[model samples]
Target: MQHVPFPRSVRQKASLAFILVMLLAVGNVSIVQFLLREGDGVAATLNVAGKMRMLSQRMGLSALALHQYPGLPDLAPDQLPTLFDEAHDALRLGGRAFGLDIPAVPKALSPQLLDVRQAWMRQQLAVDALARAPAGDRVAVEALLRANTDLLARTETMMDSLVVQAREVQRRALYGAYALFALDLLLLGLVGWVVSRRILQPVQALARQCRALAVGDYAARSDLPPGDELGELGRALNDSAGRIERLLRDIEQEHAALADAQSMFNGLSDNTVAGIYMVDESLRFIHVNTRMADMLGYPQAVLADGFPLHQVFTGADYETVQAQAMERLSGRATRTRYECVARRGDGEPIELEIFGSLMSLHGRPALIGIMFDITERKRAEASARRAALVYAHTSEGMVVTDADGVIQDVNPAFTAVTGYSADDVVGQTMNVLSSGRHDEDFYRVMWARLQDTGRWSGDIHNRRKSGEEYVERLSINTSYNADGSVNCRIGLFSDVTEKRRREASIWHQAHHDHLTQLPNRQMFEENLRLSIEQARLGGTSFAVIFLDLDLFKDVNDTLGHEAGDQLLRLVGRRLTECVRSSDLVARLGGDEFTLLVRDIEDPDDIFPVADKILDSLSQPFALGQQTVQISASMGAAFHPRDGGSDSELLRAADLAMYAAKEQGRNHFRVYAAEMRESVQVRQGEFARGPDPASAPAQSG
Candidate 1:
């Protein structure tokens, strides 16, 4: 038979079509979601810009009121400046602040926003100058008035330009979305066409051929060209029909041979391997060949003429044998083959395969049978069935390879685990399953150990037919021949990928924070200890910075715990970004985070990192529908200067952090001896009693 190469299997083609349709559908969904998010951000930014226009004029009016009514605290206009600054930041830098959710300004509107910023700065200076001047200073009032006008004009221009740019972006995004939708539709139609032509048509053709074969059309052949699994099924159907036709023809030839056997056996019965016997209608032995006579445990003369068949053939299958003999003599069947137990001359029961045919002797219908003792063959067959059952049903994957590591056979479990059928890996080297994670030396050592001990058991990394690497616990044993030469290698393995993944996940959860996925207090302390040891040995130093987010509790109280958690995660990311890759940042829980800067050559080197952390945290964090601005009160403790051990360094860092909070929030302090003394003095003061005049003010 000629081999016809298929472009792809039916399953692969169908899967490809399904995957293409799914990708298009997902792509459209993703594009829509992305555009909607961007649109939300843009709309929010425009709204904030519109509010800035109003805010510029409102601030000017409030300033004028404050100048006119300095005695009324309600008309102080202090909040106006703060509100104006918040709006300006929201419009220029963009985030959710004061409920004005937005993204940063677009690049096209950056110049306009810079002009507005400059104008706002001049107005801020005038406001400050007016506040410092005497209440009746007309020059101060006039300067403030001029700055407000310029600021208002610039805000309007920036807002107008932003609206134009936002419209253009929205229009382009809409066109792009429309084009993507159209392309998705076209691909879906193409997929449908492929399904019809490549899958449905071949399947229908195969179905028709199957129907023809079912109606006794043994000559039918499915003329499907090989391209997929459907084509392979068609070919298999054709082959089955041909096999049935051949079997029928073989039966006819067997019948012809049976007819000739009746006369041919008379001359050759004594020389044949199997015992031959003739029986009359009365079921008595009419003639027995020499082999048959020996099988009956009698001389040829005693077994001949009137010997009862039951004497040597007495077993549970006697009735079945009698019925089959009758069927043969009645011409119901030209030949009958059956297996039954028969007693040998030694009184031992043995399984026999008997072929019986109808024959004529002295014009009377008789039965002639050729019998063979199949006792050993039956035992071998039963053993083979048991072995095959174990091979097919066992859960562990089993592979048999030649001494040279060429794969010869694989059990069903092997295919289930490795995604490779026996036909796929047979005749291939075991290296086909190599994951390449192990170097050549690894395999060389494995083989060396196996050669020395004739067995190797360990975990091995291998790849599946799908190109996914997995680990398996494998045990391989060498099978040897009688001469002690290696015959084959048998390997049993079970997939351990999931087990390994679960172990890894557990370890990660133990050492990392669940909310931020950052190193937790435990891991951070371990690293700190390690850093201290390394620094002490090398005569180098490292610094530990402890930070507490200011107003973090206020955020939680105002925005809910979920928002607080989001803020913490964002802060973790920003903190990570602030430090070098060699530096370690960890959350010490709640609002506390710690950083370890390694190989600090100077204590002053820690100040820059402290500043960066403060600055990064000062940026606004967008949490769901709200945005929050927060800062960190940080403290730094050097290795030797802040005491040597982990506990000492941590205590120093804690004292300095408290000092930063006492000095005022949103500040950092390096660990100093005076900080501890100050803390102890404050503790003593707290123990005595609260003194309103001298007590340090606390900020949250």
Candidate 2:
């Protein structure tokens, strides 16, 4: 009754061909749209499912917190259920939720989704009951915990099932696309063959008859049947055999115009900066313009003769390039751009950037490619990378600042040395690190020198983030713009605080006594000289006292040198505590010490200092477990009355020391004129035998 529909005329067959093409296009589009929807829907559903699991856990934690601590506010008890319901609806049906376009649950995963929904309902009920329960409600907390655990388990199962179903759908879609493509290709080939036989053959016959008529054989005819468009065309051609000469003249002029257009196109292609070439579906070179031939160090004629692709692209990227060409021919992609390495004619490797597209050339599939040589650009990139590596790893702190000293960038080493991170210092001025140890004049002179010489380097004092002052050896270089104005300043520095500290330590060790940690004779003599100069200039007076421990040698002999050294250290500390901070204390040698008391207003001031020294020395000292009592003989001399110079004052003090020893073992004497005479008078007796009264003796 329907009268099977079949194409019986040329017009019907042509319409059939167009319908097949439209069907193939529509089928491909439908498959693509379905795949995209399936992918997006699976992702959105999985996201919502995962959130439900997390929400279950969150509710349990909040409930536990409320139970453990009384008077605690509920954490999202009211809003959480509402959110859960919305997400649940979005997942079960299809809608936009939580910023995601969710699709309805798949038929295959419907059972798992239903199970999750039921479990979540139970968990929701438990959460509501817990919210109303009192503090320390162990029963309510435990019930919610159990419900949430079950809900979480079901959610995980639903997600697993979702993933499995999504994979299956994608797999089926891929197979369907392959089968559909094969069917479309078969249909296209069959349509083409049918058209060639039913339409092209008739047209060719008409063309031949016309050609015969143009050459004066007017008896020719196409001999085609009537009724369809092709049959009508053949009949018309047979009737117009007499007019073939005029048609032939018009076709010749059209051919001439096409030749001129092609010549102009070739001329522009050869003159372009980029290399232009074309390749057939088999990847054999179909055309090579002059620029392309010159770029590859090959003759255009050689490439156009179908040079092998392997020889043209001799690099590890050959396979990738081949894959791109195949994708283009297979209708997977229409255009592509990529970088690859190629060999020049001299076998030297070069980098190239290529832009390619699929095109029809002479009614056959081909690829048109444009190439640019990027070897120099790649080399410059590598150099920049090496420089960046150095800047990051170098130990020296580096900072770049604008002409006005606003900080722009800093390296990691800068953070290490300054104790300031990039976030703390960037966009700030260099004064952030100022220690305020230098005056404005100091900076003014520094900038003056930099502006004159374009460089400045010195030891600078800077403060750390922790408010500690440190010294750094800093060097700053100035960069100028083309107009000779300052562009930027680059500073490189190293923290030299520890290095300078070590230097000071070495100086102290050289000038101080190692045994007692006091100023040694060298530093003591220097201080005395300095004091003498100050006293003379100010018309003031100072006292010098030379002291000797009476029983020091005996302690050394009885308790060994170690014990004597311990006693000396204790004596030094006590002597320091007894004197003014302005006074100087020194250990001259074994059993001998000196003191310089400056700015004495009256001569009597020296006596109290001498007495305090004697009293401090007389106190009992603990050596190991043994206590020993010792006395000292001290002698004092005044500045102008005793001597005007360091050498004379020291001699007077020495003379008075012996006089104190001659007077008694534990006494201090001011230097009188007779002390020096008394020392001379007893010189022969001190040489003959030691004076028992002044001699060293052990004190119990």
Candidate 3:
């Protein structure tokens, strides 16, 4: 019988246990039966052989007994009942052995067992024959014994064959049992395979979940029917996968948010008002934002892919900016500002102001530049500067100030006129220059006038830091606020301190001949007015004296007007010395001169000065080489006594001088209004002839 390997659980438990019990029962029963059969058969066979041998020996002894006890004759020779009994018993044992061998022996050895049975029978027959024969038949008994021996040999061979056959049969039966065991094991495996289906079902489901996860099927799950640990594990897998799906979704959402933020930052960088650009270590433009692109009239989308920035900036300028940015990065400088011209897309040039700084992007050195158009602002500033320069070089002093009378600005002309540098006066109150020549009340009046009329003009004296004073022709105006408030005051002025001095100089040149450099008659009369002011103020009386150089025109007709003029200068100097420093001297015309004496109170007080002037002219004049003589006729004017004005005084004095000339030459005369009856008028104006003193000189 084949053995089936037992399954550890389920149906195999009871059935295999039962089968094991049954098989063990059967094996024990069969083993006991076989043991008993084999041992009894072997013992019965040995008993049979022993019984046959004993039967033969007994027959021999009986025969020998018959031979030795022939006289007794009680033992039957052919049919001894007792001997048959022993023989029968021996045959019964042999038959029992045959019966045992029939059950225990193999079929292949049945003949050999049958032969042993037949040989035992033949030996029994032989022994019976020997017992029936007479005692003389000893030869027959010997033959029978000999035949039994041969039969025994044949029986031993049969027993040996049966033993070998039985052992061979036992081996075959053992092999059969093992074969049946293999078949039982094969059947159990088939049943086990069917049993494993329930288990493999869950495993297959787990495999599907794993496959789904591998293929990114986050929704896919084992979904195994719930029962045991496998099912719970499947559910856990589904939960884990769900969590992974959520994580993936979260990751995706974060990625999108990051992308959106990056886009926003990019937009701001591109669209900022300030141009932005980045340059790499090679000094090539690495990135350019929209504003930077727009600065050069380029679209960002088209130009963000960098070009060499040096194409726009000369290499020298680029390097300079690079160096400066590097310096700033190294903390070498505070701040640097640069401006340059940049070309547009159309090749037109415009001014740009650039500020560059050092920074790193993506872990590499880069220059960040901010630039803008400064063209208009730069041009306007340049124009304002030119106007300022023009104002600085102007010929007249100018002060520009706000409405508070504070100096906001000044020019070089102001510095020259005021003898102050711009630094000394800027921002100071305009009152810093007030000369105090004008009263505070006057300034109040001026301010009131300006506020009322929006402007005021006057001659004001202002002082300098050096303590020098100057007169300014000042015109000040108030600049108004939009709301009509006074916002600023502007004052412009010219220094006129030298005005009176220049006037006196021109007056001297106009009345006198250029050659003699002395006051002429016109000025002599004008001096009479001043002399009267002196006489009235100082309680002094002064005379107007007129003299003509004698014979002065004759030399001019002979030599030239130049030589005559020279002689006139000589005469003018001689007359000039004859007068006191407080007196006035002038050349009336070509040969005439006038004098006004100051501080003469009495009428006799004038003649001495007149006589001395005449005496000085009587001297000879040395004209280079020729000596010439000249004489003088003098006229005098007295304030209040001669005439009320300079004209009246000159007229009275000239008539008196002509009278003196009529008396004698080289003399002086005192003016008297009573003698004026001899004067004549023509063209309705006084035709006053030569001086009265000179008329007498002409008479002489």
Candidate 4:
């Protein structure tokens, strides 16, 4: 049989299609180039016209300034030269707009450009005359200003005309471009119709034939005419149908084998413990194993209903899965392994570790992911993490050591307390921090407790890396292994140096006067009692001296309390100096003070110390900017002679002090038996009437 020849091969038809597309692209480029050229010309003309108008206005203003003030200070020295240069540039640009020295301008703006040039020339001439005018020449200045104003007005009108022309040119260009576009679209539509008729129609017919053969219809034929590659394809399809018919029987046998293999694969997937799933391009699950269905708390039938991948995750988790999916699709990642909270069918959340990769499933792009339920594992991890965080962040310093007490590890608090880093102390013995304050017995006792009870706690003095000693409340525990042997030891401690110092400060503040730091009344009484006991035991006498500042209240009223406090501090220092180191000097409230003169030979021995105290206190004291003169009155009582107890001695000394005050201030008086009677009689006399002799002798 004779076969008809095809008119065109596939290569020829493809070449013709490419040529047509190239022609269309060339036409588009030509049109774009024409529009761009026209636009550039219009833009240049508009720019030149605008500059000319601005320069014209500037020259007019400059002319006015010269007319108003011709002084060199008022007008810039280069103002006239700059104006001339600007006028020249405007003229040049105006000429260039009409193709004088640059690209040709659009014809529409030619008349406007000519008018601008004339106005600019007139404006420049007027400005030149103004700049050259004499300072007092009012008539010339006025004439030049009028000319410049008229020229500027004309230049502005020309600029407006130029703008209108530019807009017209642009409108025309737009219309031309639109016309060209329409023509191009019409031609493209015609070409497309021809291509569809000659190429697509025949191709579609051949495709139907192939489709028919694919579905096991061997008799279908395209019946295409022999003129092009489509005709050749039609004949090829006929041949393919014959071959397909012959292969159908073999394919059926192979289909049986494939079905069996698929069944086996399904069986294996169902028996697997891990959940396996495949998602289509639309993120819908097209296949899921029995393990996956059960893992999601869903039946196999429900999973086969095309569940979406996004629905497997909760709201917050779905967003993360979507971001990972996008990253994989964009080729930034090939596989993703992440943990997310997945929702079961009953809306309960389960932690899942998803291991996914981009793959092709059933001829479509998809994700094949394996899901592992990690709810229990995650719970365990979270608990461990919380315990670790507490151990690391606790304020108590922690140290881990071997059974022999060699340092192994340290927490951040250890660094803060000991000023030693893990790198500095690791492998070093714990004794490295010992301040040498603890004896061998102390350590022996501590180790004995640790061995017997597996724990020890005490206040220990340890030196820091700076060689500074600090107290730490330390507790140590030994960890044991299965065989009851020591594994490691953990020590917990806190730096209590500041706490101890604060406690000491509080004790001092309580027992000592805040202003003068001398022993307060309570401490003085305690010391006096102890001294009385010692005096009685040793058969030695001690004196309890009471002293009062004369006119101290007057000093406080004259100056401020601050000055009065300074005076009291000075008096306290003098009193301290007057007493021996073994003696006790105390502030007994306000300006009164007392001293326990220990180991005195007799009551008279207290007289010299009293005199020294009075003399020291009588001296002038410099308080800031003022010199203050003050005195003290002293009274003494012997421990055994005056009284036996602290209260009795204090009372005797107080009475003697009042007697000394009555006789004269700045005087010392011993506790005489008659002094007590004298105080009582004086009190009775003062209650009655003033003594006639005691009354300040009438000044005359």
Best by TM-score: 2
Better structure of 1 and 3 per TM-score: 1
Model 2 weakest 10-residue run by lDDT? 681-690
User: What are the lDDT figures for the candidates, one per model?
Assistant: 0.83, 0.83, 0.69, 0.77
lDDT of 4 by residue, 596-700 (tens): 888888566777788788888989999999999988887888979999988778878877887898888798888888886777533321111336754311100
- Compose the digit string of candidate 3's lDDT tens values, residues 1-700: 1385434333444465556556655765676576566655655545544554455455545655655466655343544434434433443333433233323334464565556556656666665676677877867677677767766676567556645655655666576567556755765565455446445667788998889899999988876666556777888999999999999999999999999988965875767577777767676677777778877887766555667666676656667766776676565763567887777887877788888766777887667767878888898999989988878777778887776678987878888888888898888977888898889899899878976898989888889779998787888888898999877777777888898458757876777767777776566666777777867787767777766555655666666666776787788788778778878787755566677777776889777777787787888878888887868776676877877777677677777776666667787777776657754321211224445553322110
- Rank order (by lDDT, best first): 2, 1, 4, 3
- Please provide TM-scores, in order, for all candidate models, with all chains considered together: 0.38, 0.39, 0.34, 0.35
Could you give candidate 2's per-residue lDDT for residues 580-621 as a string of tens digits?
899999887767788888899999978878878888889899
C-alpha-based local distance difference test score of model 1: 0.83
If ranked by TM-score, best first, what sequence of candidates would result?
Answer: 2, 1, 4, 3
Query: Which 10 consecutive positions of candidate 1 have the poorest summed lDDT?
Result: 681-690
